[model samples]
Structure formats: C-alpha cells, structure tokens
Target chain A: MTQPTYDSLKVGDEIPTLTTPSVSRHTLALYCGASGDHNPIHVDLDFAKKSGLDDVIAHGMLSAGYLAQMLTNWVPQSALRSFNNRFTAMTQIGDTVSCSGKIVEKFEKDDEKFVRLELYSNTPQAQTIVAEAVLVLA
Target chain B: MIDKKHIGYNFPPVTIPVEEGRLKFLAKSLGETKAIYTDPDAAKAAGYPGLLAPPTFPFMLEIDALDLVDFMSVLGETLEKLLHGEENFNYYAPIYAGDSITVRKRITDIIDKKGGALQFVISDNTFTNQHGKIVAETRTNYVFRHQ
Candidate 1:
C-alpha cells in the first residue's frame, strides 16, 4: 500500500467511498470509549426515545469517522492534512451511511503540494456535504 | 420551550497529542483492515512517517474543546432533551502523528426547529506543532432537542 505522491493527483478524481453500518448503540459506545465523549444521547436508548429520536442516535463524530476512512484510503494514512465537517442530520440505528469525496482543486502553495476536496456523508434519506478541505501531501 | 443563550459564551482552547493506540482501535472498530491506520510500518511504506490517524480523528480532540458540553450540562437539556440535529466540517490540512492541536471553542449559533432545537458552534480547532507549523483547522456543529 504505497501512497502516491501528491504530485500525481489531478482534479475530478473521485475519492474512494468508505462505508460503515448504522448508528447502532454499540457504535456509539465504542466511539465514546475511543474518543472519550460520553454524551448520553449516543448511549442511552431510553434517553433517546425521551429526546424524540426513535432510538439511540449515532455520534456526529462517528459519522464523520467514515470520511476519515476515505482519506486514509486515498492518501497516506497521515496524508490527510485536515479533517473538518458539520454535524448534519442524526444518523440512527439500522441506517447505512457512506463517506466519500472528490478532488475539486489541485495546486502548489508555499512550495508545498495541496489538493482540495468536497467531502460527503450520505444515507438513504440524507445527503450531507460535510465540508470542503485542503490536504497537503509529500 | 427552553432557551439556550450563545451570547458572550466561549471556551478555552484544549491542546492534546494525537494518540496512536486510539486510531488503531478505531480502525479495528470500523472493521478497516487498511494498513495505513493500523500499521506504522505499513503507513511508512505508504510514505507516511508513522501510524497516520483517520481524517475524522480531530473531532475526538475538538469535541471536548467546545463550550457546549458545559453550557448544555447546565441547561438541564439532559440526554432526555438533547438531539443531534446536524453536522458539518471544514478541513484546513492533513493531520499527522505526534501533532498537538489547540482549539478555541464556543457556541456561535442557536436556532429553533419544529419538534426540536438547533445549536451550532465554532470550534476554532487549530493544530500547531511544537515547531509552530499550523497543521489543520476544524469547525463543527452540535444540535439539541426541545421537550
């Protein structure tokens, strides 16, 4: 899995699609454990039902987590320059989500290689463009 | 209906080191067998310095940097009244291992929605290494519910 130098990338290339299962209670728990974010909305089903969501919802970071997968696969593991996104809709249990991105621009700045991406996280009922990002690679 | 005020609210930036074990654990949970996130040698083979973290990894660091937790914690919007309405991110650059990030966070927006409430915040999450190279920036949103 040798990473390609940013020198070879071009505009319009579709970044790979990374998929993760729905926002199961387990996903939130695992995410909370890994990330140390213990918001109960992501854990307690009784609490979620009370909050008006059908059941426990996934953490926004977990949904965004898939996008990170896309980047690690596309560039070198750490090649991801920056990862930022808005927490759009709440993705629930039993929903399948896909994370992907496409190269929007490419150029050299400050004598460094950089690529711009329009990233997204989509479910059957929702489509969210998490945000635009710039990745600097070697 | 309850009111969440954003006026004159902000949080001190939180700086943290990127931990490799956590990324490795996340890759496993994601069922991702990709060597880049799993193996340092593999990532090195892929042209990285070491175990490169996932792109969304910053959220873990930025999440606590927000004033929302302390804000909402005091609002009585307990998990019983909170809902995650939406999320979006703006990336500044790629994040690498051994990098420390300083994020200045605060609630920037508060809105009302049918059947729920919306709260948006700007986590001026900036990553600067010991050498002062700004590695990346992250802005995020957090939504709540109405009871």
Candidate 2:
C-alpha cells in the first residue's frame, strides 16, 4: 500500500474507513489476557449480569486499539504524535464496529508538517466513540 | 460520594521491558498487518533500529502499579461499579523492542457527577525509556457508577 505523503494530504481529505469483524467473547478473553485488564465486567457473564449490565462488554481499550490500528495502518507508526478517544457507550459482544476519520486541519510548525483529524467509531446500534488525533509527516 | 482528597496521589513507578514476542502478540491480537511491528528486517529497512511497536502498544505495559481493587476499597467503592470512560495518549518518541521503559502514574482529578451517582477518577502517567527520555504520556478516566 502506498503511504500518503505530506503533499498529498490536505484539509477535508477522508481517511479510508476500517470495519472490524464481529467482536466475540473469545476475542474479549484474549484481550483480557493480553492487556492484563481482568475486570470481571469484561469476561464473566454472571458477574456482568449481577452488576446490572446487559452482558459482558468489550474493554474500552480494545475499541481504542482498533481505532489506533486504523490510523497506524494508513500512516507509519512513527508518524503518530497523539491519539485520544472518549468512550460514549459500551461495545457489547457480537457488535461490528466501523472506524472513520477526516483531516480537519493542516499546518506547519518548527519546520514540521502536521495533520489533525477528527476520528470516530460507531457500532451497529449507532453508539459512537469520538476521537481526535495529530500526526506528523515528512 | 467520591473523595477529592485522593487527588495528587502518586503510584510507585514500574519498569517494563518491551519484548519482541509481546509486540508481535499485540499486533496479531489487534489484527495489524504491518510488517514493521513483527519483523526486525522490515523495521530496519524502514529506518527503525529494531522491531517497531504499534501506535497503541503502550497499553500493554503494566503502568498502573497500584492495585485498583485496593485503591477502590479505600474509597469505599467496589470494582464491580467501575467503567472505563476515556483515554488519551501523547507520543513524544517511538518505542522499539528491547527498550526498558519506566512509567509513573499519579491521580490528577476526581469528579462527582449525577448527584454522586457517578464519579470519575482521572490519572496521568509518564513513560520514560532506559536513557531517561520521555517517550509518552497517557491520561485515563475511570468512572464509578453507583446503583
């Protein structure tokens, strides 16, 4: 895949959207092991139910990881200067997520080129996770 | 009600070594197809010193040295009511395999909302490499919901 050059990117350019496979219980389990975030709300169905949640939900970081993957897959890993997101809703198992972003601003500072983006992810149920990111380009 | 006194509490620092195998696992788990994240030769060809960590790889590092359960216990809250609310990361330098990074965490803010039914605990963490250069900073907010 060809990377986007600093010259090629401009304000209002849309990043290719990424749609993930359906989130599964097994995936959540693997994430629990990998992230060391063993909160029962993410793994134990009984615990989640008893706690008043509909079911075991995906870790917020897991969804954040997907959004980061979307960015790094397009730009070089080293080019990312910052990434942030607010978890607006729970990502339940069996939900498929789609991530999209658009360049909102472009500027030059200290002889370095930077692009700022407004990013977001949404589930099938219309729940959204909003994000903002800044990337440096050569 | 959330205690505002815990603000400014700092946790013990933890040093974590970035391992190549763990990097690969993280990439695979995230379904990343980047060769630089898992292939040393690909990273070298891309001008990196060694295996490259994915943008959010720092999430795998055990930076929260304080026990969440114990911390919540002191606050008279239970882990069952906790939820992740928001997260942010600022990258100052690239992290590569074989780098030992030290992380320091501090509680920066606590807010009570919804008439004390919901509380938020915000923490800021700094990551420094073996040479003592700051690599990244992360801010996280965890929400506690009371029934």
TM-score against native, each model: 0.74, 0.93
For residues B1-147, could you state the per-residue lDDT of candidate 2 as single tens digits?
667888998878888888888777776667777888878889889888878877666655633355566667767788788988888889999999989999888889999888888999998988899999999898888899986
Candidate 1 regions off by >4 Å? A1-12, A21-23, A77-84, A105-115, A128-130, A136-138, B1-10, B13-17, B40-50, B65-71, B74-103, B107-117, B130-133
Q: Per-residue lDDT for A32-74 in model 2, tens only?
A: 7666677788999999998898899998888788888889878
lDDT string for model 1 (B70-124, tens) is: 6466454554555444444444455556666676555555556664544433334
Q: How does model 2 score by TM-score?
A: 0.93
Who wins the TM-score comparison?
Answer: 2
> Which candidate number would show the highest DockQ if scored against the true structure?
2
lDDT of model 2 at residue B60? 56
Q: Tell me chain A's TM-score in each of the predictions.
A: 0.87, 0.95
The parts of candidate 2 lying over 4 Å away from their true place are: B62-64
